[model samples]
Target chain A: MLKKYGIRKGFIAALFLNNSIDFISIFFALIEIGATPIPVNMAFRAIELDEIFSNADPHAVITEKDHLKVIMKYLSGRIVVERNGGNFLMRDSGAGGFGRGPAEVDHSIATINYTYRGYGYPLGAMVPHIQYLFGSELLQEAVRLDAGERLLVVLPMPHIFTLIGCIFLPLIYGITPVISRSRNPLRLFETVHAYQIQNILAVPELYELLYKFRDSAGDCTPLNAFLSGGSVMPDEMYGRLVDEFDVDLIHGYGLTEFTPVSRNIRGDIRPGTIGMVCDGLEYKIDPCDEFGFGEILIRTENMTKAYYRRSAESRDVFQNGWFRTGDIGRVEDGHLIFKREKKKTRKVKGNMVDLLEVQRILMEYPKMRNAIIECNDSILSAAVEIDSARNFDSEVLSIKKFLEDRIAGYKIPKIFSRI
Target chain B: MKDNKITTVDADNLRESIIKTLAVIARINEKEINDSILIKDELGIDSIMSLEIIANIEKRYNIQINEEDTMNITTVGEFIDYVIHIINKK
Candidate 1:
């Protein structure tokens, strides 16, 4: 089938699915054609959309009516397929329909992914064919996803972490993926219960929300495993899920540059650690202090060839044929402990303050579920979730006093909130 | 326009203005506002608090703030300074 579609060479194809049939058909079509299919995130904002479009520059884009205007703006001169009375490509099963030809292609640049990093860069990173193939193999091994396993692709498809880790990885093993149209917590829970989903790949945000919803609903259906990423999953929340839901959650760590770099798939789940490195990936820790934790430099078969259009930035970051994942982390007892991103760290009153550390501390409180710490020129502020029963004044005072003694005075949060 | 004119106060008044604004926001939202009140901790402001505070300061001072100016605002004092900077820029 790939030989007929002229996709023997590397080509980029996008498809919009109205139902499970469309999604499955496209999956088979792409694999048959040897073309790498890039899934556009439906939840992406305008800036994110612009980045994905500009960076990917896919040969063809298939989208629905709701996304026509945005997709058209990005794929102005490229071939566009409209689906289901929408400005998207239709799923063609016959010969010469969508992908039905072979061509010589560059094996280096096959798949492109946009990590939702606000508005800075459109395409966060690109994955070459070899890397994508290698990533699929490694992830399948790490997560123990086999042909018989039924997987749930609940995270946004546009993200490389989910696309490769969950969708493509499962597909490679011949496991069918249950794709959900919406990400609403209630709907996601219903989908899980209805589909009897054994494996799930989602962000920590989604997991936390689902955990809360499941707690209130009182219907606890057993799930084989849950995979979380995108942001740090607090140990407190992890404990809550284990204690309440009796579900073992695996934490996956990777960026757009390298998908599924490290993961905790087996037992001895450390709350904060991202787990051991995956196969075919080599990692080195350049610790700033004696503890051997400074910068995380990685080289893998799955690393991107380059960042599109940002050659200078790419050159600066990609050193000695290794991608320097701006994040600072340490390896302890065979587990990767993420400290903070180098760019986000601030020097407050002569003390190096990791804002992520502050955030983790704020979120540690039982009353606070999620917290974001933002620092400006002279002051630091924290946004925290409030327990309904706690008094705001007392909570704030305790938090302030706690930080004042533990951290530097400058690191103390001047502004506090439950918002 | 004349009636809408707000008096330009000193740095002390600017600081007080920010505190008052925060207090008013807490009262309106039925949240407890105190010196150490975590803006997102007591209420559920999220990222919108940054926008709301910026908007309130703009309305109160009749000044415009750019993205660069907004970067300095984290605490109440810095937020007041941010407003003053915008006021001076205007």
Candidate 2:
């Protein structure tokens, strides 16, 4: 089908669809054909999708049936294909194709992983296939996921956290990952209890939802350990999962450019720190200037070469075989301590404030669904989605006090509105 | 000197091409559309598709349509009028 569309080697193919078993085959097939795959987040609305389409200029776009209509509109003068997902993935290509050893499909540029999180324009890092192998193997060595480990994957497929933790790690260790198409939290918990699943890897939000409804688990649950990344786990939730719920929860660190960078060992961990650096990678922190904080940089054996279509931008960071992560952190007691994300920080009244740090603190607040802080035209404001559990006006009042208590007054958004 | 003649083209001919293109885009027949149809509701012309239709019109007519004007034209008939006005102005 790609050949019919005139997509040759060294071309870019946009993978704009939700998570499913089919995502695995389509992703590898594109890699096997030597074309780089750019996995577009399915949750992006029109404006966000428009930004990515212009940024990556793909030769062809493969999307789910429902996403076809929307994705086609964004693509101009481009080939589009639809995938039905799940069992249809295993069905023959209808072309009756040929062969290549899975291990031999290495060292080629695999994907331009879209890792941007801020409200700004999307940016992708060019990751080679070797990075995927090294990162996944590093995880397999640390976690020791046995062949019998029944893990349920809940995070979105496009995220680096999910790709390393759920997909590649399991495949490398000969463990079968239970890929669920359902997005409902209830169905996920049901799958865990019903399937006798052992391990879970998810973002902090999903863990919080399960914690909120802990009674749903009742007495008998098959879950043994939980691994979390993409964000720091709140202390309250961490304690509840470990002390009350009797599940092992560990904090891991990863970025889209390189994943499974560092993950806490099963039994050895410390609070307020993202675990020790994984094998085959070295990390360092710059000397603090007038403060106990410095930027974190890493020299990895298999880190991405540069940003896609933005070589000059990468030059500012990738120098002397060291990649400067725009993350501010410090080393304390031999563990990496996260201070704030540099990209999301803004200067307010001569003080630097991290929007992501504020968003993380505001997300788990009472009656708050989600909080997004953005700097638009040099003005910082927060769009807080208030849960309908309480009166809208009253929730706004409580949220102000909540922000005042947790963050600096200058860091608080000048305008707060319910989304 | 007489070679530059602005031959007035047939309005129905241009309108026919527009209708056919719209039918192909909406995946419906030209018979289903008329002067009173709301493109947003009847044809499901989403925001991105609206830009796509504008691009198609520009390609087919060999002319450029102002994007700002395209946003305000909601109905199918209005889109046709906007294209005709741009061509006639030339």
Candidate 3:
């Protein structure tokens, strides 16, 4: 079918798919065929979709039946392939042929993964196939997972952590990767017991859910370890998981540009640090302050070289063959101790929400004089300096309505206050 | 003697009230909401907002909602039915 549709080498396809077997198969198949698969977040609304589609410039869009209508709005004569169960339905809108991508991107790139680091907009990280192997190799050594063990996966499929840690790592190491369709803690517990799953790689949010539903989580004894990333884990939550559940709650720090940069070793775990830097990467803290903390710089052969179509950001991030990870941290006794993030972003529900971007979107409303967005313990609130004459209540509602379509649901502030 | 169970009219009122509450929380019009629309997916409601909705329903009805009952709920209709069931049980 790919050959029939002229999906040859260098073909870029946008994947608007759910977390299902089809997503995994299609992803690997695209890579196998030498095509670049852009895994788009399912939570994205049409507005976000439009921006990504415009930037990605995909030749074809592969989506399931549920997302076909939403994807069709931005198809613009590109090829559309709807996967229903085991069958494939391919059609061409014929408005035009395959859309041209930016000529600057390397044609041999493995995948284009979209990421946002408080950049107001997302940039596609052009990850090579070698990074997957390198990242998985590092994780395998750090976690010490045997080939026969089962690894539970419940995170969003489009996320880079899921792609490398959950999907590729398991495949490469011969471990059975159990994919959970829902984040419902009860259902996940059942999956763990059913598969006798040993380890899990999830964000802190999932671990929180497990803790919340611990009383109901029937027999999670088979679980050996819980690897956390994507966001910082609260020290209290980490303590509870370790003390209550008796699981190795390993915390790692990495970005979409490069993954498994540093991780806590399985047996020799540290409570308040991101553990030692992974092998094959050279890292340093630039211009340490009084506390011996600075912006972390990593030089790795397996890191992303460019953000697709974003030349200015690409140049800004990659300096002198070292990728400036916008994370503030210090090394104490060979462990990478995280201090704070240098970027203007907050992790809401384990997803990065750029505060400046939210403020910018809030300022788009005509009535607002200024907007200040803040996060306290992962709860986002927006205080707007609106015209005093306008009804405060109605304007608050209007701001909520304005933000609903512009950004993701999680990015929308929970509380609105007058500044 | 009086019946403890909520009548059909009472259920209708409760349903309407819940839908309106969800609409207000999701920042959408009541007319935009349908029984079949997904609470999280279509309405752009996240887990935090869902908790708010659950809290509102719990306070209004004077009942406690368990995590398991709300966790597997996919659609708005399911949520409405579950709440109505809880109210009836009360």
Candidate 1 runs further than 4 Å off: A1-38, A45-57, A85-105, A116-119, A216-221, A344-419, B1-90
Clashing pairs in 3: none
Query: All models: lDDT?
Result: 0.61, 0.67, 0.81
DockQ for the candidate 3 complex? 0.12
TM-score of chain B of each: 0.57, 0.82, 0.91
Q: Residues A1-419, candidate 1, lDDT per residue (tens digit)?
A: 33433344456666544434465566556645666666655534344455455565555556665556544556554555556642233334233223434323345666555432222344445567767677777666666765777777865555666667656687678877888765555556667788877777777656766665564334556467777776677788888877766667888677778877788865756778898777678888865678788888889755885665556767877788888877789988778888766655553322334566566556656667788888764357788887657677777877765553333344557678677
The candidates, ranked best first by TM-score, are 3, 2, 1
Q: Of the candidates shown, which would achieve the greatest TM-score relative to the real structure?
A: 3
For every prediction, compared with the true complex, DockQ reads: 0.02, 0.01, 0.12
Candidate 3 deviant stretches above 4 angstroms = A99-104, A388-390, B1-45, B48-80, B85-90
Candidate 1 chain A lDDT trough over 10 residues, lowest sum? A86-95
Q: Per-residue alpha-carbon lDDT of model 1 for B1-90, expressed as tens digits?
A: 334333564766776667776776545432344344444434323332444455566556766555444543444445555566666656
Query: What is the C-alpha lDDT profile of model 2 across A15-127, one tens digit per residue?
Result: 87677777888787788778778887665544446656777767667777666656656555555566774322222223222221122112467888765434244566788
Q: Which ten residues in a row have the lowest lDDT in candidate 2 chain A?
A: A96-105
Query: Per-residue alpha-carbon lDDT of model 3 for B9-85, expressed as tens digits?
Result: 88788879989999998898999888887776557677746656776676578776785478668788888889878
True contacts kept of each: 0.00, 0.00, 0.05
lDDT of 1 at A193: 81
